[model samples]
Target chain A: MNLILLSPNDLLTDNRACIKNPRQLAHIKQVHGATVGDQLKVGLINGNLGIGLVTELNDTAIYLDVDLHQAPPRALPLTLVLGLPRPKMMRRILQTVATLGVKQLHLINSYRVEKSYWQTPFLEAENIREQLILGLEQGCDTHLPEVHLHKRFKPFVEDELPAIVADTRALVAHPYTETACPCQIEYSLTLAVGPEGGFIPYEIDLLEKCNFEAVQVGERIMRVETAVPYLLGRLF
Target chain B: MNLILLSPNDLLTDNRACIKNPRQLAHIKQVHGATVGDQLKVGLINGNLGIGLVTELNDTAIYLDVDLHQAPPRALPLTLVLGLPRPKMMRRILQTVATLGVKQLHLINSYRVEKSYWQTPFLEAENIREQLILGLEQGCDTHLPEVHLHKRFKPFVEDELPAIVADTRALVAHPYTETACPCQIEYSLTLAVGPEGGFIPYEIDLLEKCNFEAVQVGERIMRVETAVPYLLGRLF
Candidate 1:
């Protein structure tokens, strides 16, 4: 963990907090090899980042005296609308989006998305938060990305999506498209990426109607986990 | 599997091939749902991509009338120098590099790289090839990337790295650097990415002496797997 993320409940005072979670404690002792009086990078959830001076270090917890002074990095000016991936890839995808500074993520259903994927326990709020927190720790950020789910395709695209795409450069990543995915664009973007096989023609047509232009990355197709970072790097 | 990749061993004649492997057979039957006369995308290993018409299909094998014609997508004009990732991540990294069209990859040792990483079975030729093949199948490409291992860092940098970086833009992704990574450069590149926790100052200095510029992606620190795709997207 790059940053010791503290929740409000962990606070003993405005400046004092205790990291009692086994996971964080283990990481602190084992990976970090931190001891008392050593300062560590720390951040408060939805707040600022700073340093935590290790006041007490033991097996159970590490008590810290924190100073919150620095702001987190800027969030990406993009909204990701992704076709819900396979259940196995869900955690990594959530972590990736969070690490890449994606503040808004919409996991929607597509023709190629298996119905069973929506039933995965990975989509549970607690489970999702757990993954996102891990991502924040890796990325060393404070703000969390908001994830929204839409189980139905057409209704989400027809009703909810238009408003989201209104002020952005709407795009859908497709292999069949001739237009290359634009690079280093200055404007905000709302990008939609399909599942394994890709969005069906009817789905593409519906997105097109919502002003989303189909863009191709390259001839070689990438898994969604890889594609998200690739797209973000190219665009932002 | 997006394309049925055929090795020379799989070919029965110039115009025919039979897939008897359980993996391919299951994918063709269960995923593609192919039957006699059904056409599927096919590609020869390190050769052209084309179509395979199913001539016979059963439990044991799927016979095809092969017609290889189209060339595979262009390979990226870049060489990747990566600190050998953890054993568990090695398979995915190999697959990702291949899927992204990277043809030359050097898995080198770094100060932060664990000594045990060098001992992974994933570094074996057959295991590496297996992951690369899976990547090619996922990417719908034919050419497999060449992976080289370097157990010693100093010798590789002093002796072999200069020639590799001579005709290309040499860059090392370092989080401590002030320079932001460039984008959309129309030139070949040789990129070195460190293992988790990054290269030590001495290592960075050595790279600098060899004309490698240290560049940063952003404030957020990403896992090596995520960083590779991110770097490729930004550079290429």
Candidate 2:
């Protein structure tokens, strides 16, 4: 963990906090080998990032005298609308999106997305929160990315996605597209990426009707895991 | 597997080949559900990529009417010198580099690289080749990236790295640098990335002495896996 993240529940007072989670505790003790008086990077969720003076170190918990002031790094001016990748990739995607400072993520279903994916336990609030927190910790940021799931495709695209794309550059990653994905976009953008086999013809047509222009990354096919970072890096 | 990769021995004649490898056979039958007359994407190792006509399919083997013409996707004009990540990450890195069209990769030792990382069986030739083939299949590419290992840091930096960096834009990813990483460069590059905690000051000094300029990706610290794709996306 790059930053010691504190929730409101961890506060002993306005200035003092204790890390009780074993994950963070083990990381602080074993990975960091932190000692009392060590100044650590600490951030409050949706709050500020600053220094935490390690006041007490023990097996159970590490007490910190907190001073939070600095704002987190600027978030990406992008909203990712991705097909629900296989369950195995879900956790990593969550972490990656969070780490890259993506403020909004929408994992939606497509014709090619397996129905079993929606049933994954990783989608549970606490589990999703854990992955996002891990991602936030990695980025040393505090603002959590808002994740919205759309299990049905048509309604979400026809009713909801247009509004999301109204003020943003809307694009979809498709192999057959002649247009290349643009680089270093400075304004808000809503990008759609599909599942393993990609969005079907009907799905593509629907997206295009909603003002989402299809763009190709390259000639070579990439797994969603690789494609997400690749697209994010290129677009932002 | 997006492409069924073929080796020299797989060719039975100029126009025909049989896949005997159980791994590829199982994948072709199970994942692809291919039958006679199915046209599958196929590529020859270090050769060309094209379509293969499935001529025979059974439990014993699969036969293909081979046609090869198209060249593999252009490789990144980069020689990446990376600190050897832990064993679990090693396999994935090998796969990712190949998938991204990286031609040369050097896995080197560094201050923060655990001593045990170099001992991974995943570093073995057969094990590494398996991962590369999986990557090539995923990317529909023919050429496999060459992976080099450097068990000693100081010697590799002093004795060998100078020549590797001589004709390239020699760079080291260091967060302390003022220069942001250059983008859309068309020339050859040699980039060195340190392991988890990053290179110590002394090592950075040595790299600097060898004409390697330090460049920063961003403020958020990313895992080597994330950084490789991110930097590749930005630079190329």
Model 2 agreement with the true structure over A33-69: per-residue lDDT tens digits: 8999899999999988999999998889899999988
Task: Kindly list the interface RMSD, in angstroms, of each predicted candidate in the order they appear.
Answer: 0.6, 1.0
User: What is the overall TM-score of model 2 with all chains considered together?
Assistant: 0.98
Best-performing candidate as measured by DockQ: 1
lDDT per residue (tens digit) for residues A70-180 in model 1? 999999999999999999999999999999999999999999999999999999999999999999999999898999999999999999999999889999999998999
Steric clash pairs (candidate 2): none
Global local distance difference test of model 1: 0.93
At residue A51, what lDDT does model 2 achieve?
Answer: 92
Q: Distance from true position, residue A176, model 2, in Å?
A: 1.6
Residues B108-183 of candidate 2: C-alpha lDDT, one tens digit per residue: 9998999988888999999999999999888889998999999999999999998999988888999888998887
TM-scores for every candidate against the unseen true structure = 0.98, 0.98
